[model samples]
Target: MPELPDVEGFRGVMQRCAGGRRVDGVEVRDAGVLRGVTARRLCRELQGRRFAQPWRHGKWLVTPSDGPALVWHFGMTGELLCAAPDDAVEAHDRLLITLDGGRQLRYRDRRKLQGVRLAADEAAVERILADLGPDARGLDLSRFLRLLSGRRGGIKSALTDQSLLAGLGNLLADEILWRARVRPDRSVRGLDDDELRRVHAAMGRVLRSSVRAGRVPARRGWLTGRRDDAEPVCPRCGRPLASGRTAGRRTVWCEHCQR
Candidate 1:
């Protein structure tokens, strides 16, 4: 699944390929990936409008134009790609927006799971984001602690819950917890202040590195790199890693490291 870092990478793609560019055409090769708007309405609303600066919040990417804003939620298999108009469209290229120049922006998705939404204005965009909690990347230590303080669940569950803290997915949650030496099934309330602070700092570090790499890097020293190994072990310690489900998502942690 495309998580926060992946979505941020797509935001960079949007800014580079379509920012401030005039829309020459809108093509909906597969309408199954659209939400709350029909193919005809999408073309009508965005055909001639110029795209403004694109931004991202949590896992959502927003491309604002003269009228409505295009909101993208890349579910499990969705991604945005930049290509030349003459380039061949891939099997999953569901939507394409041709810019004024030679570039074309493609919305490609294999699962077609959460797709696109057309927000009529800034207010509409807010309505779409209202359900989400504060973005994880922008949270400070104080706010991060506060957000976790009120939630009652396993630490991993709180971390991955969009209503509690947006942007973290299964991989990030596991990685952050591992770095903090906190177990996936540890209760939020059971953690001491020091543990919470460690979690907050770990989140910041993980996000910074992931954003720079444009994805959660599977570096040799990182848990993400070894999670799928034949017999995964902790990078910090040689003990074997353990796996289970938390918050309905697969979670991996080091029992010897995380307490």
Candidate 2:
């Protein structure tokens, strides 16, 4: 699934490929990928308008124009691609927006689980995102502590809860907890102030590097890099890594290190 870092990367693609360019045309090859708006209305609303700066929050990408704004949620296997006019279309290219200069922005998703929405105004946009909590990338330590204090569950559940702290998925939650030296199954209320701070700091560090890399980098010495090995071991302590379910998602952690 595309997470926060991946969505941030897609936001950059939108900015580079379509920002400030007039929309020459809109094509919805698969109307099922659209949310709330029909194909005819989408083309009518966006055909001639110029796209403004694109932004992202909690895995959702938005591109506003003079009229309705385009919002995207890249469920499990979705991506936005920038291509030339002559480029061959892929099997999952559901939507295409032709730009003024013949550059194209394509929405491709194999699952088509979540796709696009057309928000009529800023209020509509807010309504669409009202259920999400603070974005993980921009969360400050003070707010982070407060949010954690109010939640009750295993630490992993709190971290991955979109309504509690948006943008973290299974992979990120596991990676952050591993770095913080906190067990995934540890109760949220069981953590002390020092542990909470460490988790917050670790989240910051992980998100910074992940966003820069445009994905969770599976680099050596990082837990993410070793989590999928045949017999995965902790990159830090060289101990065999443990795996199970936390928050109903697959979880990996170093028992010795995290304990």
Candidate 3:
């Protein structure tokens, strides 16, 4: 699954490969990966335009052009790749934008759960983002606490709720809870100020490191690295890890470390 960090990486790819380059052509190999726009219209709209600055909010990537902005959401198995014109076409390559100077930007997805959207203008782009809460990276501690202050669901559920706080997925929610030493099933209404502060700080730390790594890096010292072990144990305390489903998502936590 592509989360905030992975999408951020994709934004980097867009910047490096297509920024300031004129779009020579738009090839829609699979129209199923497009939303709200026909293949012919997409090609017509973007054929002569140039990509300006690229932006990312949560797991969504937006590339600004002279006309409509190109927005993308990489679902379960989607990625944006930059390749030479002569490179072999990938099996799952759904959309291809040929740029000037012989470079091509490819949108590839295996599951095709969520795909591309063409926003008519800046207002349309804002409309697309209207349903999402403040991005996790830009959310301040005060607002973060306020968002969770009176929430009714479990902590994990609250963290993973896109409407409440966008960009956190299952791995991120579990990792943040583990680092905060809070159980995933604990209710937000029952949490104390110290616990909230711990969670806020952990979110910042995890997002920073994960964005730099371009994913939720599974290191030996992190819970993510040990969760799938034969008999998972806490990396911090060496206690057995507990596994269960929270908010309908698989969750893992350290029994001793996260109380």
Question: What's each prediction's TM-score?
Answer: 0.98, 0.97, 0.97
Worst 10 residues of 3 by lDDT: 131-140
Sorting all predicted structures by lDDT, with the top scorer first, yields 1, 3, 2
Can you write out model 1's per-residue Cα lDDT over 5-27, one digit (the tens) per residue? 99999999999999999999999
**lDDT tens digits by residue: candidate 2, 109-146:** 99999999999999999999999998999799999998
**TM-score order of candidates, top first:** 1, 2, 3
Better of 1 and 3 by TM-score: 1
The number of the candidate with the highest lDDT is 1
Q: Is candidate 1 or candidate 2 better by lDDT?
A: 1
Give the winner by TM-score. Answer: 1
Return model 2's CA RMSD, one decimal: 1.0
Each prediction's whole-model lDDT (CA): 0.93, 0.92, 0.93
Clashing pairs in 1: none
Candidate 1 at residue 203, lDDT?
97
lDDT of 3 by residue, 1-259 (tens): 6989899999999999999999998999999999999999999999989999999988899999988899999998899999998899988999999999899999999999999999989999999888888899968899999898778979999998888888999999999999999999999999999999999999999999999999888997999999889998999999899999999989999888887
What residue runs in model 1 are displaced by over 4 Å at the alpha carbon?
A: none
RMSD of 1: 0.8
Can you tell me which runs of candidate 3 are displaced by over 4 Å?
A: none
